[model samples]
Target: MLNRKIQPASYDINEINFITPTIHQFKNNIPLYIFEGGDEEIIKIDFLFDAGNYYSDKFLIPVITNAMLREGAGDYNSEQIAEILEFYGASVRLTTNRDIAIAGLTFLSKHYEKILPVFEKIIKEPNFPEKELKIELNNRKQDFLIENKKTRFVAQKKFLELLFGKTHPYGNYAELSDFDEITNEQLKNFFKNNYNSKSCKIFIAGKFNSEVLKFIEKLFGDSLWGLNTEKNIIKFPIQSDINKIHTEKWDGSVQSSVRIGTLCFNRLHPDYYKFQFINVLLGGYFGSRLMKNIRENKGYTYGIYSSLVSFLNGGYFMIGSEIGSQYCNDAIDEIKKEIANLYMLDTNNDEIKMVKNYMIGQIMRSFDGMLNTSETYQTIIPYSLNEKYFY
Candidate 1:
């Protein structure tokens, strides 16, 4: 029987040692890379492709291709695929950002052999069935229509357009007409152009035997497909020189949503850490200056926040809030005052320490799950960052 007794006061804390991950890498002539780690039960598979909206026609192709990936594929219809995954107690999901699309799977390691075929099918032979496309388009259109009614949504859209010109891919709004124009043929073409093995990296983080590694290599190796020779170039747009603000009034709105921001730099910037600390002090937490001054003290609004949004090419700092419609202008003015105050005053060491501890705590909390940890590393790896940044 295992001992359940509590430790004595004399117990030495230094005697305890936690097992850290054993990192392993598989190198092949193939362009793809896989990172794996785990001990027994769960296996996670992440397939990353550089086929984000920024690289394609910004309107629809990126989104449509990602959504339709699991609709149907070789030897499996959508229902069949779902049923098989559920039976094996597995989950498959897709995530996208401005620069990449990630298809991830988490399954019991014991049943990996049963689920691997389904994964192969989804990756190798996505059919992009016509019916699924129609259903998805309708759903997206309805969502957009509903979001347009919210003042916050309206403000956010207008803010992006103002920051980056309306014609730019990062700033454009999606129209129902745009969805109407996308056909199944165009979706298939986009997939064909972007889904080649050369542009992808497969990351497997979990317990696996030699067989699984061999399977991954075979699935993504020379036997399956060849490298893409075309150049993938992305250019960052020029930033707006002047500070701009725009608002669109929504009739009968009970709350006014506000967003304030300007273009900044990427995670690789030398001042990234300092800027992170600054953001936390400004609005990155419930106890932040913005929240304390605007919500807790004055009671001008229900909630407020500020954050640094980092992208592959550049980043931005934004302050967002929702206030009673009558208090919209007041909330905006107060938010600006707080920002100005930070620049005007000399920050004390005690306050800086408090904010630093808060930010560190928040980051630790975000990594409490396997999925989130894997994603954190994924985001960092592309930017050439390591765990030392957090420490």
Candidate 2:
């Protein structure tokens, strides 16, 4: 019988195990990582490239190139490709991040052979049609214009500018005018340069077979898929100028959004886990100091959170919240006091133990399936890291 009143006793995290994918090299220099089997007939395949927003020569080139991949590629137009995938109950997605662009596919293992050629064609022969490019440009530009009016959007944009500075790749933003300047020729050039096997790493999971593996090797490994394009040099020099607060004033804003943080060491550091635990105790969880004092006790704001976000080259620790405009100053003061308290006193051993346990549970839930396990591999491989990253 389970007791609702009594709580389970806490213990130190003893061990955490992660599934590491078996890596194979394709003849064309692309590396593929695999997690063998699961109960589901479905599988996920991912193609990762460093052609993210960071690598874009201009603000929109990388994104525009990635977006136009499925718009038209090798015999199948956008609607035809969509119809085929929809008929097979499969899906395709391309996501652009600060560091990379991922082209992902999910389909039943039975359809792997049928769609592998289509996938190959999509990867190697994307034609950025003028009609599709025009439609996408207008849609994205109009969407941004609408979202730009929100306080959250304005705050997040300003936050990146402050964190990375105006000159850094991560900081430079695409403006409305930049959208108008995107050209099909530029997209073609960028794709030829960056979206090649030389810049790609692959990950696949679910019920795997040797035939499918051979198919992958033949399509990607045995061929010169990228035509051996040379990668361009993109510089991202870090700035020591931090510890500054950037405020974007909005006259109509009834609520003030605040982002306070500083760039810190990435996950490769030994102290990262410790710092992550400290962040949780500070505000990473509901019972954290900031939430308890600011929201639960003082009636100041609705919510608050602390995060230690690790990137490919750098990381940052941030405490974020939005509050009534009138109490903005008070909220800032309280946030500082909470942080100061951490350095001012030693944390209790029991409290530290609890946070560690919470993190362990979180990791278990995150890596629960083969798909998630493949994602876990994706995150680590970008940094030249392996399973030991967790321990």
Candidate 3:
């Protein structure tokens, strides 16, 4: 085996400067902002809205609206949209999380001028064609049904239900009945209420000029801005007083999946970094304590890991593992023992230094590409943070 201790010639990472994007406040009096960058090869545009599921009449409204946005708009059908975008070598993506929805576009800088009009039509006039909605709903329901049969899925869903009550927006699972309950009229109403200029923020990165800015102004600024019909703020319930444990058996499974966690704080909390460091020492890395104890030393499982997940409305620290079904109880007991030990004693200086280095290396890896960098910002912007937090 190769030596893992061969240090590279240059350990200096000073050249990696995390620069915050230049912000340009639009004069249009709309809730629009832009982050301008100078790369001339690729251009990215992100339209963010608070149309997340929390504000909808039902849990799946945001899901349907986001999925249907790119299916058809204006004179183009789903296939035509795909063909046009492919012809220009451009990509259009739509994503929805617990509290926000984003529609984004990326294309070669040379073709940006040609592709901007297509994006404008898609964003401004999406037609929720009935046939497309039925197909998507059926596809999603089937996927969910399949996933529910797995041990990991059972453990994860149960863990969330335990952390937050089953009725809570963050904890609720979508049912096939819920999909059938959704109608095209409800989706259109949800879109009209949330996808207005006043509720959106635009982010542009890479190769923008005065003319491009003018085009953006004409397309987005001149449009009438309307406020959302309703504003609902999601408040995560307090962490449960009890340390909850749940288990479900799936017959004929070779391995059992386990998840353990509790509701935690958002990124704005001062303890976010501390908890992140603690998590690394516990199970965040391959060489973490949990892996060493469960996989390396005991040979009970192939892998084990944990993470701190922060959403717009709330966050949590989760540990997950898959092991031979016979070792399920033993693995869970060891995990709890490790967690209790972390709270009882302090880690040593050597371990602390190693975790810090590992975290820094991971942060650098996350910024290695343009798309990843853009996504990093998208994840952080909702917390009212800039890149400086990571640097």
Candidate 4:
């Protein structure tokens, strides 16, 4: 019997053991990282490619190419792909960002033999059918139009454009005309150039067997496919917008979205961890100073947050919120006051202890389970950092 009134003992977490992935190489030299642990007979496999927007000459080429990969590959159409995954109780997710593109699949470990071949075809022999390309582009254009209407979306987009200049790949945004202008030929060409064995890494997590590993190697590692050439590295200069302030007014709007930030250092910077700690104390959590000042004290907005966004090329520190139009000026003034207070006031040891405990708890949660630890590893893979980064 347990006493409901008595509290559990709390001890300082001095160390955490992380489940590191076992590294292997496919026949064609593709890297495979497997995190094997857990009781459930489920597994997640992620296919990472160096095919990202940085490699595209046009605005929508990389994203469109990524979408079309699973649309129609080999003899499987989009419907067939969906049907197969559904029949096996599996799921697939495709995503593209500025630095990398990923195709992730999750299913029962028993189903790996049936599903791996389907995904293999999707990655190796994508046939960018014109009809599927048009459908995807049209749907994306609709989403673009809808998102542009929201103040927060507009502010975020403009903020990136200001930080990285329009000419740089990170800053460039897609226009409506870009959707119409992008053709199947362009997507096909981009896919052929970037989605190759040479530019690929495979990550598998959860419970799987030795037979499963050999089967994966048989499917993906058997041969060099696509262009089979080394990735071409390209560099672009960062030309930041010189202006200190930028504003775009929207007619008949009841709210004003504010974004205050400047470019900062990447995760590899010596001060990265320290800067992240300070950010959480300021606005990264519910008990942060910004929330305490603006939301609880002034009743200005529901929530406000500050975050340090790190990218392959660069990073930035941003504070953002959408406040009532009438309170915008007062809210901005309050935000600046909070920033100044960080420097003017002395933080008590109690507050410091609280923050340290909060951050440590969050880190522990990230490594609580094998699947979670693997997902956390995904965040660091782009930076080429090892598990030691957590420590």
Model 2 ranges off by over 4 Å: 1-13, 239-243
In terms of TM-score, how similar is model 2 to the real structure?
A: 0.93
Best by lDDT: 4
lDDT by residue for model 4 (1-391), tens: 9998999998877888878889999889988988999999999999898887888766588988888888888999889988999999998889988878998889999999899899888888888988888888889999999999999988887887888888787878898889889888888789888888888889999898899999998888888877976665778888887763334447788777888778899888889988888898999999999999999999888999999988788888888988877888888888888888888656888777778888999988988777788778877887899888877
Q: Which ten residues in a row have the lowest lDDT in candidate 1?
A: 11-20
Separate clash counts for every candidate: 0, 0, 0, 0
C-alpha lDDT values of all predictions: 0.74, 0.83, 0.80, 0.85
- Model 2: how far is 146 from its true place, Å? 2.0
Q: Write the per-residue lDDT of candidate 3 for residues 262-282, one digit (tens) a residue.
A: 788989888898899899999
Which is superior by lDDT, 2 or 3? 2
Q: Which has the higher TM-score value, candidate number 1 or candidate number 3? A: 3
Q: Candidate 2 residues 92-160, lDDT tens each?
A: 888887778889889999998888788787888997889999999999999999988877677767777
Candidate 3 residue 380 C-alpha distance from true site, Å = 1.8
TM-score of each: 0.88, 0.93, 0.90, 0.95
How displaced is residue 163 in candidate 4, in Å?
0.6
| TM-score winner | 4
Residue pairs with backbone atoms closer than 3 Å in model 4 (clashes): none
